[model samples]
Target: MPGPVFLRGDTVSMRTLERDDLDLLQKYRNHPEVRRLLGRVHPQNRDKVEQDFEGYMSNAVNLLACVEEDPVGFVALFDWNESSGHAELAYWVAPEHQGNGYASEAGELAVEYAFDERRCHRLDAGAHATNAASRALLEKLGFEEEGRRREHVFLDGEYVDTVLYGLLAHEWRD
Candidate 1:
């Protein structure tokens, strides 16, 4: 079965998550390292993944980042408020694939899709205040810091601040 191709980068392509991709997705999403930064609201079990794949996916753009058919990461544009032309951006790369620019590549495509194709005026992303890597990536993608929410989420053992970032359509180069 063919999956929907939403956007393409130089080394990675972002495609809609398909039913056949559930197992492959589970492998990445359930990884301890990958899940640590996601601020996951629920466990990524087979049942929930399948359920979300079928229902929640329809409201947002959730794409897998693949390199020559091998899944390396994921980019999601969720919580879209069309009336406000805004959405939340999220992504995670496998432990082995970090520092390769795959996430940035996939993120560029997703942000383009959100601003250029989807006509969204703003895209929001938040990272654990301690996550320097994500903060750097967001900066590389032209996202500006909006503010920080102190002790916004409880993760691992204690609460972590949420560093908010935003990109506006007018600020997009393309």
Candidate 2:
């Protein structure tokens, strides 16, 4: 509900993103396959990362999925406004951790925070249509597809539709 902190679930635990996580975050950053799946942006260097962390300080809603003290992935809630009582969710599981159910588990806890703890009325997110894995994860978490924006993102040299999905506070199940 406030700043990110350690969140424990059955199979994994999520901790707040920290500057000390640079090495682990960089591991994902430098992995070619991981970068490709994350949309192949220009590689991030140390200076850029330093600035990125500085930016996160103001935005400030983020979580890191961990297991046995090892960094596995990240999940974040943002776009917060007290009056609106809603926030957008986003997450990424490292390539090595992709098939382990980490995102879904961590995502559930984040949703709980937004709806139960933070008293948020709605939670929403979008994924590229081609990202079947992400789409399936959202659906499994009870999010419904609301709409799609055709050719909204330029990915891999071609336009891809962005699929919007959402779940209301009343729609959530434990």
Candidate 3:
């Protein structure tokens, strides 16, 4: 049998999100740099953290990225339906740890899990039009730009386009 969490790459370890991760998630979620890149929806307080934690724990496909005991990032296979054998993957890294290839490592691991372990045929990622770093990272990890939804999300008093990317299992040879 496979472990509860599958190891993806050497740089970081992938594991299931647990209740103990609430504090760490809230810390990164509230960081100024992270908020600027990802946008903050609500205050990451105790109540909000707890509520989010509940959803993560209940979601079977939720995955957390860690460096030893430190919570570095999170990757989740969201909006999954068995009949489709497909899932959308989303991830976020701590602001302080940006540009260290942590996100790419986390992403590679997520893709491996989706393909090799979960047997998923494809993985999809969506990034804001202005988020060049995110888009570049996804491309480097073998995700191809599928399309763009112009002005789909209204953020910061303006609508922004979202670029959709997809990576198939066969494309991730590395």
Candidate 4:
């Protein structure tokens, strides 16, 4: 079963990620279609996935996006710096759950938590240049495209640019 609700939205609810959801995490993390876009060129074995989960549990505000008890996606505010009040946002939806607005809703909830609940001064996100959907989603959440790193990451056998985005607490409309 999923953890208790941490943030609720119209059609999606964000819950704390749990060890029980490791299978769900692995399902999407290893899915070829999902991995490519996420820039994960290699498939993660169960042990690696477990390690990543542990890191998330220890270091990030990781949440599982669910619909009526079924996990559809994941979201997180990681790399937090309390003194600077800064953090990075990252999220991904299952391939079967893509285009249902779950990610967008979850992202809004995350941003709200960052600025209001966490008292964050700024938030940052990065997406591969080829990931138009991700870029669009970040912009839709009021994140401004601050810069692009030329050929920053090698993915799918070629180097890809990384688009950096930022949103300040004062600049947030909500």
Ranking by TM-score: 4, 1, 2, 3
Considering only N, C-alpha and C atoms within 3 Å, which residue pairs clash in candidate 2?
none
Residue 127, candidate 4: C-alpha displacement in angstroms: 0.4
Q: Could you tell me the C-alpha RMSD of candidate 1 in Å? A: 1.9
All candidates: TM-score: 0.92, 0.88, 0.85, 0.95
For model 4, the stretches where C-alpha displacement exceeds 4 angstroms are none
Tens digits of per-residue lDDT for model 4 on 10-113?
A: 99999998888888888788889888888887788888889998765579998999999899988989999999999999999988889989999999999999
Tens digit per residue, CA lDDT, model 3, 1-174: 112456757878787776667777677778776765665766789788788667643664666777774667777787665577678887788866778888888888777778887788778889999888999988998999999999977677788899999887788865
Relative to the unseen true structure, what is the C-alpha lDDT of residue 34 in candidate 3, on a scale of 0 to 100? 71
lDDT of each: 0.86, 0.80, 0.77, 0.91
The lDDT, on a scale of 0 to 1, for candidate 2 is: 0.80
Poorest 10 consecutive residues of model 2 by lDDT?
1-10
Superior by lDDT: candidate 2 or candidate 3? 2
**28 in model 3: Cα distance from truth in Å?**
2.0
Candidate 3 residues lying further than 4 Å off, grouped into runs, are 1-8
lDDT of 2 by residue, 54-125 (tens): 885448577788776677787778888669888888888888788988889989989988898889888889
Ranking by lDDT: 4, 1, 2, 3
Q: Write the per-residue lDDT of candidate 1 for residues 34-57, one digit (tens) a residue.
A: 777877656688988898788888
Best by TM-score: 4
